[model samples]
Every structure is written in C-alpha cells, then in structure tokens.
Target chain A: MNSSLVFLIVFGVVILAVILIYNGIISRANAAQRAWANVITQERQKNKIIPHLQTITDQYQQFESGVQEKIAALRSALGGLSSEKMDTAKLAEVESATRNLVQGMHIAVENYPELKANELFGKLMREIAEQQENIGAAIRIFNQNVEAFNNGIEMFPHSLVNSLLNKKSTLHTFNDSEAEAGFDYKPNF
Target chain B: MDKASPSSENKQLATFLQSLRTQIYHAKTREDLRHVLHTVRSFGRPLCYNNTSYWLGFSMGILLGLLAILYAYWYPSSVSAPWLIGAGGLTSVIFAVLIYMRRSKVSDLSDALFKQDVYLDNNWQSVPYHGKKLAAQLSRQFSEFKRGNHSREIEWLVKGTYQGTDHQFDYHAYHFHYVDQRQVTSTIRDSKGNVRVTTRTVYDHFHRYGLYLPFRFARNIAITNSWFGGFFSSSYKPASVEFNRKFKVSASDELSAAKFLKPAVVVEIEDLGKALSGLNLEFNAASELCISFEQNICQWQRQHGLDEPDAFLQEIEGDQKLATLQKTLERIHTLMRHSDNNF
Candidate 1:
C-alpha cells in the first residue's frame, strides 16, 4: 500500500505483460516462416518429378511440344526461387506451367489406352498427384500461420505491445485459388 | 455352400437355433451339456469366459459389501464393528458356496449359444485365427494402435474377398476388443495430518468392429474425431477447413496423407463419424487398411442370465442384423472408393 511498493508492483506487472506479448509475436512470425519453408520443400519435390514425367512421356511418344515448352517455363520460373523470400507472382507462374504440362499429358493419355495402362506411366501420375497433395497442404498450413501471425500483431493488447516493442507488420495469406488448383486432379484412366 | 437360397439361410439358421435350444433344455447331466457345448463350438470362437463362475462369486462379494455399507447407515452407530466385519466374512463363504453349485445347467449355456447365433447370422466360420498375433502386428505397424498396458482380442473373424469395380481385395472382418488399464493413486490426509495413500486399478473397455484389407496405400493416414484426436499426433493437417474443424487427420508422410484424404473421402468420413462415434481408420505402409468403429451396427444381443432356454435364440433376428451391417458396409465401401478416386 506504500507509494514505492505500489510503483514496484505496477512495474513488475507491465514488464511481465510486455515479455509475454513479445514472445507470442516472435513465435507466430517464426511459425509463418517455417510453414513457408515447408511449401518451398513441396515445390522443390514437384520440380524433381518433372524430369521423370518427361522421360516417361517421351518413351510413349506422349510428350507434346507444348508440354515440353511448359516444362521449360516451369523450370525457369522456379530456378530463381529462394526460401529466404516469397514471391506470389513467380509461384503462380510455376503453378500455371505445371498445370499445363500435367493437362497435356492427360490429353495424350486419353488418346492412347495402352500408354495410359503402362505401369511406369501410372506410377508417374501417382507421384505427380502426391506432390500436388503435399503442395496444397503446405500452402494451407502457411496461410493458417499467416492468419495467426496477423491476428497476433493486429489484435488489442498484442497490437499495443507489437507497436511499442516488436514493430511487426500484418502478413497476407495465400489466395484460395492457389490451394484449389492443387486439388483439381483428373486421371484419364 | 448351401443348396438352399441365400434368402432362406436365415430361416434355416432360425430352425437350427430352435433345435439347439431344445437340446440345451433337455440335457440332464454335465456330460450331456458338454456334448451340446462342443456342437456350439463348431460354429465360431465365442468371446466369453468359461470361468464366469469365479466372476459371479466376486460380484456377489462386492454386492454384499455394498449392502453392509447400507446396513451401517440403517443401524445404530453403537453397533460393534467386529459384527459387521464378521458379516463381511460370512458373505465370502456364501459366494464360494454358490460357485460350487454350478453343474452346467441350461443357464450356463447362454455364452456359447450367443456365439453360435453371431456366427450363424453372419455365415462366419470358426477357424484358428490368432487374436494376439493381429494385435501385435497392429501395434508394431501403427502408432495409434500401440499396446500400452492393454489386452486385445479379435473374435468371430470372417475372411472373404470383396470385388470392387476397379479392384478386388481380400478383407478380414471381426470383433475387436481391448481393455486399457491404468493405476490411479490418491493421497488422503486427515485433520491430524496423517496421510493415507491408496492405489486403485482403473479399466476402460472398448468393443469395436474391425476390418482389415490388404491394400497398399500411398501413405499412412489416421482419421479420428476430435474426442480421440489427442490420442494421435501428426505434423500434417488437412487442407479443408471443415475437415480440420470436424476431425483430426494425421500421417507419417505428408504427401500420402493428403492424397489419401481427398475432399470426397473427407466428407464421407466426417459423415460416418456423425453416424458412428469413435470411428478410426488407419492405412499403414505394410499394405493394411484397418477400419474400426465403436458402434454395434450388427445389433447383437447377448443373454446375460438364466432366462428361457430360447431367450437369446429368439432375439437372434438375423435378417435385421444383416441389413444394418450391410448398410454400414456399403458406406465403408463408398469411403474406400472415394479414397481411390482421388487420382
């Protein structure tokens, strides 16, 4: 109840609040980055399957010229990709090229029943579908983390703490279209 | 294979059960009863205890102890404590005496009769299928089915082939039961600060319908409702917001899990969860597809005590039981198709 005692108690409470909020903000920011890293990992996995797709398609004469061009475009778009930064436009470009190549193969497989039934072709298509699944999951996780981070830095008491100490900005989540495109898998067989 | 039509299998089973009930009622001696019991055992492995007499005795003792506690409240507090203790000892003697009177009466034949009914109803055959082997295999392959101070058994297992439009697979369907035991210790302190520690054993019993299909999946995925979600742990999350909210999905491989849990599969599983509580599906790397649900969709009824010789047999509505089971199987078949249709 004394003046100095009251002052000390108030100071201690304020310091604890600040420390808690600061830790929360830092944790959310780190989680968002980790989720983005996972997305990058899945994207790299997709890239690794491109050569296998080309090889099998070529063997069956299913590789169209347009498909080859899209594969090249995909490589170029993803070549300068870095986990240190996120570029949505470049990611969109890589996704579009990948879709075109997959769709091209789908058309070719539809025209040839034997090629569609080939064991290796079936395995490669499964692999592509698997990569697409992982990519969708990763993107959704990243968006969830981004939403959490934004909520942490923009909410009431946390916002006051963030502005005064951490000075973090709100993050934008991935568009719904990006996640939806990954799930539109159509197998010819 | 029977020359009779599948539609008449139920009526034939019902007639067989009626004759079996008569034989049970007419059996005069323990030897006669044992002969009838052998006839029942030819059907399937019964999930019942032959040493049920011991359980009856133990239960009688507990009942007497509970009555003694009630008597203490009714009588005066000044009543001697040794008298009450002597009564408790007397109850144990009575329990032992009752257990010794078991002479394989018609009443003692309910357990075997129930098993016979289940096997006949499902057209399931009794074979030398080891329950412990399957439990150990499941524990070894899947983290969710890991053995943790639990005893498991699979009984009345039926093996058959299911021919789907796109694939044909062999399936093993059975009754799966496991009892989880935990030791709970509590400390009690009196006004004088004297502490008493007591340890009690607690048991949780789970009865489930389990099916195992030898199908290889791209990845191992575990689907369970929110209630049992904490029991499983995984780094991967489903993309659908509705699924993520309704169920807990996890897998060892992210890609395989996501691919296995397509949007259609997610919706089907979620709807199944709403229909059947405590439903769990696990697809493992060992090419085993295991599905278990806690609901008794088969509607099996067991006679617990000495009623009429035909009490349990009369309750065996095979047609109704098979109809419900078929509906559930169709739903599960739909789920399997949805998972495959992801590609």
Candidate 2:
C-alpha cells in the first residue's frame, strides 16, 4: 500500500507539471494571435485615414495619377487585413506597399504648394503618421510574440510540451526579395 | 626585455590587484589572477597633493579673461583700437592655453576607478566577456537607415554573465541623417557629361544615447513595447490603473510578452530601470533590450581634488566615481539576471 501511495504521488507531480507546461504553450500561442490581430487593427486604422487624405488630394492634386494608383492598392490590401491571416510574404508586400503609398501621397501633395500649407492636410498627415506608427508598433509586438512562441516550442522541456501540442513555427519576417522586386517607386514632375 | 624576472614595483602592483580581485569576487585562483594582472598597474595615476597652484592658475586665467572683456567694453576709446584688441586677445589666448593644460591631468578618483576596473576586467575575462552590435541585426529587417545616413558608436562598455549566458552591455550614441536623395537630370548633355543623372545625398545628423544589451537567444522570440507604456515618462497612461505599469510588453503572439515579462523579469527590469536614474528602457526596438538614456554614461569627471593625497581625508569618504561604478554594476546584474527569460 505504501509503494502504491508513492507511485500515486509521483504520478500526481508529473501530471501537474504537464498541465503547467501545456498551459504555458497555449497561453503564448494565444498571445501571438492577439498581437497579430492588433497589427491588423493598426493597419486598418491607417487605412481608414486614406479616404480623408484622398478628399484633400482630390481638391488640390493635379497630374498625380501615380499616387491614386498606389492609394487604391493600399486600400485593397487593407480590405483583406485580418489577425494572423497573411503569411510572411504577403505581410512583407503589404508593409512595403503601405509605406510607398503614404510617401507617394506626400510627394504628390508637394506638387501642390497650397495643399502643402493647408491646415486640414497637416492634421490629416499627423493622424496618418500616428496611425502608421501604431501599425509599426503592433507589427513589432506581433513579431515578438511569434518568436517567443516558437522559442517556447523549440527549447528543450518546453519542446516536449510543444510537440505534444503539435504546433509548428510561424515566422513573421520581411521578404527582402519579394519586397524589393515589387517595390518600384520614383517621383517625377 | 626581462622574461623570467620582473621589477619589484610591477610585482607589487600585480600582487595588490590580484588580492583585491580575490577579496571581492573570488572568481579566479591566485595563480590565475597573478597571470591575468601581469604588468598591470594598481594606480593608473600617481596620488599627489592637488595643490593651490591649479586653482591659482584657473583664477588668474578667469580674472584675465574678465579683464580683457571689461577693457573691450569699458575702455574702447581709452587706447588705440588695434592695441585694445591686442591686449584682449593676448589674455584670452593665455587663459585658453591654461584651461587646455588643466583638463588632461588624471584625478585621484580616476586612478582608483581604473584600478577597480582592471581587477573587475580580470574576473570578467575568466568569466569570459561578450560584446556585440545588436542594432546591426535589426538594420536588415527595417529601413531605419536605408534612405539616409546613420552611425553608431559604442561610448562605454560593461560585461558580465548571468543565467548561463555571457552578455556585454554597451552605452551607445546613434546618429541618423535624413536626406532627400534624388536623381537630377541636366538637359545640357555633352561627351564629358556621361553622368547625366546626378544623385545628391545631403545628410545632417541627430544623436541620442542608449544602454544596449545584446545577447544571443537559445530560440526565436520577439517582444515589443505597447502604445501606452513606460514606467516614468510624461506621455504615460496607466492602462488598467496598475502601479506596476512600468512597461507595457507585447510578444509576437498574444500572451508571449505577458508570459515572458514574468513577475521576476518585470521586478528585476523595473529595479534596473529605476536605478538607471533617467534612461527609459526601450522595449519596442528589438528583443535585445535597449534603454534610451538620452545622455552620455557617467563620463570620468575632473576629480575635484577628491583623490588628492593631501586633501582632507574625511572629505574623501564619498568617492563619487567609485560610487557610480558600484551602482552601475548592481543595476547591470539585476538586468541580466532575468534577461534570458524574455527571448
């Protein structure tokens, strides 16, 4: 009976440890998903300001169809934004496109000196900058979560728990080749 | 030239430094410590009376400088214009020379600091130090310095090991230049004008200093700072009303940063951040922590006669440099103790 009791106690400790480790992995994975969601939220925030920006652009901008095309592309990308939905390559394309569109809009505005000094345009730009910053911050957060989750799954002891969960690594990275190839932006008068 | 035997002075210096190292950390053996301190000096500067001469010279220089300024102001018409300017320039030059000469003398406290660092370095070498450029890794991932010019300088370095990892902490000053680089095309193209499109890269630099801890991760991890975060900053919003809102951590995933920023890591990082006095720990930069100090690390100051052999011994009780070093080491230890948990 004493031997059986010892075996039971040992079994109980092992079970408790397994529960703790499994819980830790699930918690981290959930966090990664949440951060990815936040990235989407921030990107959408930036996207919402684009129409406001376009209203101003339509009033002042002349012969800057390049900007409109870029804006349309960015708007299209934002339409499909969702939590943990875009793979690494798609994410890279979206990020690059977003930056280019924002910059192109600013360049197009430069062609119109009056718009450059317009108070409404200035306010919209500030709002857009804030939104873009929020998106940048969210991406960093998302990347951090993905990395930590992967680490948790990859590191020993934790790796054992991760294997039990049957989870694989999901990298959040900038696709340099794709980003460079897709990005062909130039400002001309 | 002498291989087997050393001068008695060198031997004594080595022995003293070795003893000091053993007494403090006991991380190295006597034989090993001795070997490590070979030809190292106990005092980088000889202790001496910080006499009234330095003060007298400084005062004389200041008085002369003032007199020149006063003459230029009050007696512009009293003398010939050239002579007036000449007298003023002469005094100013003398004072400038004196100031230059006075600045380079190593202080008593600096000597002590050097000796202390030497011993610490010996122990660190045994523990095996680490040094790395952490931001270099992020440069590839982001376009932070792509369109413009950027430079990074390691201003100061401190190193130690914790949680079975070697880490070298650095105080870095970074300068970034944003320029409008555009291709300019000229209509006047000649045989010599093969370079039709000229690219202009005009750069102006803005610098900021931060404490950088670069360490290799056993596995992949990413952590970022939240929009409303930071322990002691003006733009602070206590999201959820918690006093422990020093940092808002976000992992690559939902709960990754929350789990990684464990109570142990948070408490330790908080203590370290607070002890840093002013630097705000930058959590969003990368997984490797970077605390933006916004100023230079404590530069070795002019000793203020604190290390003078002839100064009042009682006044020497507060060795400011040594105290600063002690505080810095303690904070660094606290920071590294829980660093491995994050990534």
Best by DockQ: 1
Model 1: residues with Cα > 4 Å off, grouped in runs: A1-13, A56-62, A111-114, A176-189, B1-343
TM-score of each: 0.50, 0.39
Clashes of 1: 0
lDDT of 1 by residue, A93-167 (tens): 667777877887787777777777777778677767756765766677677778888899998999999999999
lDDT of 2 by residue, B13-105 (tens): 445544544443442433433332331233553333233444565566556656666766877766554564565556656655654543433
| lDDT of each candidate versus the true structure | 0.64, 0.49
List TM-scores of chain B, every candidate: 0.56, 0.41
Q: Whole-model lDDT for model 1 versus the true structure?
A: 0.64
lDDT tens digits, residues B1-343, model 1?
Answer: 6474533554454454556678755654444554554565464533222445455666666666666677777774746544655676677677666544433433444755555555554554555778878767766765445534678766557764545544566666777677889999999999999999999999998777766776564446677662443433464564444456557777776677766665445555656777776777777777577777777664555644323333333354323235655555665665555455332
On TM-score, the candidate that comes out on top is 1
